[model samples]
Target: MSKLDSSMRCHAPVPLAASHDRNARRTLWVVILTAVMMVGEIVAGYITGSMALLADGFHMATHAGALGVTAAAYAYAKHHAESGRYSFGTGKVGDLAGFTSALILGLVAIGIGVESVVRLVHPEKVDFGDATFVAVLGLIVNIVSAILLSGDHNHGPGGDHGHAHADHDHDHAQAHGHAHHGHHHAHGHDNNMRSAYIHVLADALTSVLAIGALLAGRYLGWVWLDPAMGVVGALVIAHWSHGLLRDTAGILLDRSDAQLAGRLSAAIEGAGDVTITDLHVWPIGAGCHAAIVTVASTPILSAEVIRTRAVGIKGIRHLTIECAGPA
Candidate 1:
């Protein structure tokens, strides 16, 4: 009987530095723009005694803060990509940032909901003229910021390599006894960027609701609409926050992607008379995954053979295979 054991580390096929730079730059610009708008709204609200304007301004401040975190995370990840301290590199830095931002988003949602409820219970006099102008302005700013951040989401460090197999010469690499590095594969979404985009979108949504409420109250005397819209916005924000949290948390917890794992399992078992005893898969960066697999096979089958069979599975950049055979 013979046993073959092999371990391979595959770097993500796409270059991350450029993507990181792009995201960081975009986030920074948005932060600056958001901060300026936030301050303006706050100052104008105070000057004009418009509670709606003040509240929206405060909301914008939170958006700026969340975006600032995104920018910082991108910069940190880019700067530390080559640092040996990160076992899987700094790819997941964005995920961490995303997680934090999600928490902030959830809090913001709660705050909005709570404030809306309070206002609904105790309706206040809103300066429609000033508040409406600020709300419209805020909406415009949010729209512009969203556009700025709307670059190709796929063109980042976490760019997907779903087609990594198409260009991969796996057999050739095996024959040459060289490990594959930086082979492209389809990647999943960049959670960090998504989180940032969500923040901007959420803010934009609130601005729209605020505008509608202010308009309705000004003309139709539907003052309750303002708080009602806030409640709706909060619910929307909460929903997005929950989704981001779930995804980022799954990655941080090393949850396996079921679909990818299923594909990997099928690929391995199809190659030979092998039974997979154990398998573990987790994302290490955007659009990249690492896996460890244990297989039991006939005496004639070697680990190299199994490894060859598992090649071309997209997004799997690192693999460790252990093969056991009858003695």
Candidate 2:
């Protein structure tokens, strides 16, 4: 048999688990603090009878729900530290959690929009003094929450830095080859937060809009504008929700392989140390993916060889390589 390709040499092992845990912990704290604040906002809105405050409260609830998922992800990761059921560990649990949260957020957006529209049709006289006070309080809360989330390293689309950071015995070069696997977790969480952020922003905007509407309705007697503001807020949130749902559904269904194709192919071609022909890739779960490659080389390269070479390419794990026709 032909000798193993010299270019197929191994590199230092990467630390994926430890890093992953750190991020999970960070996310847990962020979500926990935000959830607590969300509950408070909901109660405040009810007591004050402020539409804008209620709207902001609704947005906070979604964030709290999303954060709950983030906490679950952290728990799963901690529990399943090393299980054969997950070939790549439970790193992608974060992504799955985020995706679920996104879907929930989208539904919440739709519900809020519908209710806002109804209230618009039958406008209520809002206590501007009370509503304004509550709205301002909500704005401060959201800003502080956002600031806390941003200060952490895990608040990104990539695991840590730009991919999943986990403690594994795998070689650094090998893990680098599949860096794409790490991104799903980050991407999912980012979507969840983004949905929450949009909701909060909309809340803030609605308050400002309501101020104008309230003044016109109370003084100028332009009642129609109040409902118009509601309609506008509903429309804006609905649009944001649609995008979040589409993206999350795509992730849940494992439909984001196209974007992964080019990157994996390039990594394999560079690392495989062999001429590449046909390379196919698909996501298996969050922060994990599988690939199949057909290469033209002197002899057939084993799956292990290709996998070792492809490890560090970003988002790749559990790779399969096959030898094609004569070189």
Candidate 3:
């Protein structure tokens, strides 16, 4: 018996995201805005001789650097998308960037916690007027940055919404689901963009907290509130960082979804007398999933027949099927 393999269903590899170019552009713009804000804050802090302003300026610089990394990731992924160097394209690049940013965010939380502890032990004199002004300015800039980074996050962080399937059979014998060839991602979540946006949100939150703490300490003599707010901000940032880390790490490691795996198995085995002997499912990119499956049947089924069974399911974009006769 002759064998025909249609290993690649797509003429070209699927894109990492539907909004790949748009998200990359948005990330670059945000990085520029953050850099500008960092410079302005540092210069103003020096002239005003306010330690709080200087601290925040330095903090902003770190996030600016992280956002710079995010921009670089996007650029690298886009330029090499069709280079054929990556076996699965550059979809996981965004996941890697998100993971790195999350680690940086975690360190920031620890640093804030330590500084707050020191401040609590040895309280600093209040230069409320200068500090408050800087906080307000930083907050405004953060808001603008947030808006620039914002997009449609309707798909949620998991990047799995009602995505259309991308199916292919090498031979012309299989004609069903041809309309679903291209990976159409209406709401593919860009992890890199989300990480950068979170940074802006964290900064804005800290600025708001700092303003309130400064006002209370200056007017009511509750100086302890300043450090207290820092602790609170640190905790909040840490929580966000942890969640981002968990999600990105899962994608990076290609964590399997048992429920999805089970469903796919049922779809194939129920098609005829086939039984799934081996199955693997993981996220490749674009809020899509790719699967490699091996099956055994009494008379041996064709790969296309098995693939056709699994088509039309949500989030499953790519599939490879192997058929072994005589289960």
lDDT of 1 at 224: 98
Question: What are the TM-scores, per candidate, against the unseen true structure?
Answer: 0.86, 0.66, 0.90
- How far off is residue 14 in model 2, in Å? 10
For candidate 3, the C-alpha RMSD (Å) to the true structure equals: 3.5
Candidate 3, residue 217: Cα displacement in angstroms equals 0.7
Highest lDDT, which number? 3
Displacement of the residue 42 alpha carbon in candidate 2, Å:
5.5
Error of 3 at 210 (Å): 0.8
lDDT-best of 1 and 3: 3
Best by TM-score: 3
Would you list the rank order by TM-score, best first?
A: 3, 1, 2
- Weakest lDDT window of 10 consecutive positions for candidate 2: 166-175
Off by over 4 Å in 1: 1-18, 46-50, 153-178
